[model samples]
Target: MPIEVLPVRPSFVARVIGADLTALSPAATAAIGTAIDTYSVLIVPDQHLDDDHLLTLGKTFGDVEPPRNHRVVQRLKHAELADISNLDANNRLRAADDHRRLDSLGNRLWHSDASFREVPGALSMLFAHVVPPAGGETEFADLRAAYDALDAPMQARIEGLAVEHSIFHSRGQLGHTDYTDAERAALPPVLHPLVRVHPVSKRKTLYMGSHASHIVGWPMPDGRLLLRDLMEHATQREFVYRHAWRVGDLVIWDNRCTMHRGRSYDDATHPRDLRRVTTKDLSMLQPA
Candidate 1:
């Protein structure tokens, strides 16, 4: 059966109307794969999926990970995956600025989740459990649109340019109080093309990240200026899709061609909880 997927917003989000991803037929599964390429973001509502269901859904796409040393305590479900909840009373994160809330708060800067790693996440599926009264909106930028919007000259200039990305930059954004020095040192800088060709879709996309620290061998000031300008150009409001989440809303986005961010909610006043699972990326990053 062909699954019905309708657009939620103009640019990238779609709501799967009558499909259960955990128990999909081959044809329905194929439809979802096709839908993901077309929509980039998919929202399936009201289905309370357990760890097995989550893993099953992700398996239909690719590898499911709650990789070792995963930050949150996602066990009883899947420790390897991330469990994003503000009410983790026993969590080591006592400070208000922990990266533990990346799905709802820490991801304010546009980025492909885990893009700083050797194997970045290919997709992210977040299910809202308890949403705060206000704020904590998720923002997504259409990289393909951003790339297409570029002028011919600027496009040509960045065609062959590679940008350096690092986990260090993201970790240090709020100050590196979270990671030990060894953990930080393990993740070295790696370079990837400024523009990437999506392996499956063959679509051209601008690969820019707030965590992208520099251009290889380029002076710090120049690299910073270039990266900043490129990101600004790519993240114009015209190309973004902002999702003001409701409880039980599930958002799945293609990490291959979309950059996402999270707007902060007043964590001090109210608590929000969401479960986040990021599928692994096969596109390995190598040092320039």
Candidate 2:
């Protein structure tokens, strides 16, 4: 069957169908890459991909990020994949007091994956192996549209500004501050442009998210206030797309141009497991 790209929103997201992700041809891979660049989010439904298959698909884009090494957090055995589940190492439901579960609560806040890192993430591909019966949707905000919607004056004001981002800052906001000194030292804050231009399409996008602590060189209180304001403007209902997940679904998004958050679910009662692989930005890999 020929591949099909169906738009899910007037701007930024699409549902890609008719291609088998497990065994994609070089031509198919190229087409999918083009589609992802054009539509920042691509939803491929009814795809039953194991961890191996998911990682293989991620490699087509760029180097997959190794699983984050949190000092006290336990991750899946494989270093390449991140487990986005509520289950413990034994595959049993985690206790309410579990640190892993507490850490994951940070996901409810809007964020672009790995934005706090020196080499920020480019793309994130998540495969839903199991889903709850209700309320586990992932919401994405269209930063590209958000940028276009800003007033000329507001755009001009932020043109040359940059922001400092840190995982500690974001998780601390959610009251999940159990990071050891070592862990905090390993993830020092990084600076990125407040407005970034897409490497391929050349479209500008608002790059601030929950990970963004404050604008660089600005007064702390004022920087935080401005960050809050921009976040509010960029996530207005008109620029958002909420994706309801299904088992066997794979959703890939461009982290560089969008912000996303996972909605609440009954994790204690319902099992919701999703595996994610993120690719590093190609620009970061290029030698100066």
Candidate 3:
């Protein structure tokens, strides 16, 4: 059967059927690419993919981002595959006060993946290996739709503004200050337009996320207030989609036009294992 794209929500997410990502033809790969541009989020069910298969599929889209400097090295075999689980490198559940677990708590805040990087991220592929019985859902907000709903005055006010982003700033929000000097140096603050124009769809999108620190030229307090206000407005119920994950499911989302956050679960009791592979956004070169 041919691949099919069916909308899960009226605004942005869709469920793709009839395609196996591990054994995709060139045409099918192109079709998935087109669907990503049009739908922004695609949920492919029953995909039994391993690390190698995940990395292979990620390369088909663009250059996959490799593991960066961190206090604990990623336990995944490949540097390109990110470990998004609540377990330690030994495959055991982390302690309540583990530094890595504390740092990862920032994922619960709504943010775009790799938006703190200078090049940012284009697409993200997150596959579930183990899912919790309840909770642990991911919620995505459609930035394009949120932008469209903004009043003309608010849109014009942020039209040419630039926002500085840093991964450290985001983790700091959760009182996570255990980063090594090397880790801090590896990821410095980067600037990007507060309002970005989506390359393929040509739609305007609100770009600020939890990683965003402040408007480049605006005072810190005022910029922070404006960012908080925008986040509140952009993540309204009408623009959000909450995804309940299942094992063997692979979810692909365009980081350029959406922000997502992981919901809380009984981390101490349940194991929710998911791995992510992100592709760099070459189009975001020289963020202005």
My TM-score estimates for the predictions, one after another, are 0.88, 0.96, 0.97
- The residue pairs that clash in candidate 1, if any, are 66-80, 66-81, 107-262
Which of the predicted structures, 1 or 3, would earn the higher lDDT when compared with the native?
Answer: 3
TM-score of 1: 0.88
Worst 10 residues of 1 by lDDT: 67-76
Task: Report how far residue 185 has shifted in candidate 2, in Å.
Answer: 0.9
Best candidate according to lDDT: 3
Instruction: Give per-residue lDDT, candidate 3, residue 288.
Output: 40
- Misplaced by over 4 Å in model 2 are 69-77, 284-288
Clashing pairs in 3: none
lDDT of 3: 0.91
lDDT (tens digit, per residue) of candidate 1 on 152-269? 9988977877787876686566565466667668777777778888777878888878778887777989988988898898788888888888887778889889998878777776
Cα lDDT of candidate 2 equals 0.88
- Tens digits of per-residue lDDT, candidate 2, 23-62, equal 9988888888999999899999988788789888888788
The lDDT per prediction is 0.75, 0.88, 0.91
* Highest TM-score model number: 3
- The sequence of per-residue lDDT tens digits that candidate 3 reaches over residues 1-288 is 689999887659999999898899988898899999988999999998999999999998999987452667667878888888898888888899988889889999999999999888899999999999999999999999999999999999999999999999999998888887888888989989999999889899999788999999889999999999999998999999999999999999999999999999999999989999999989887444
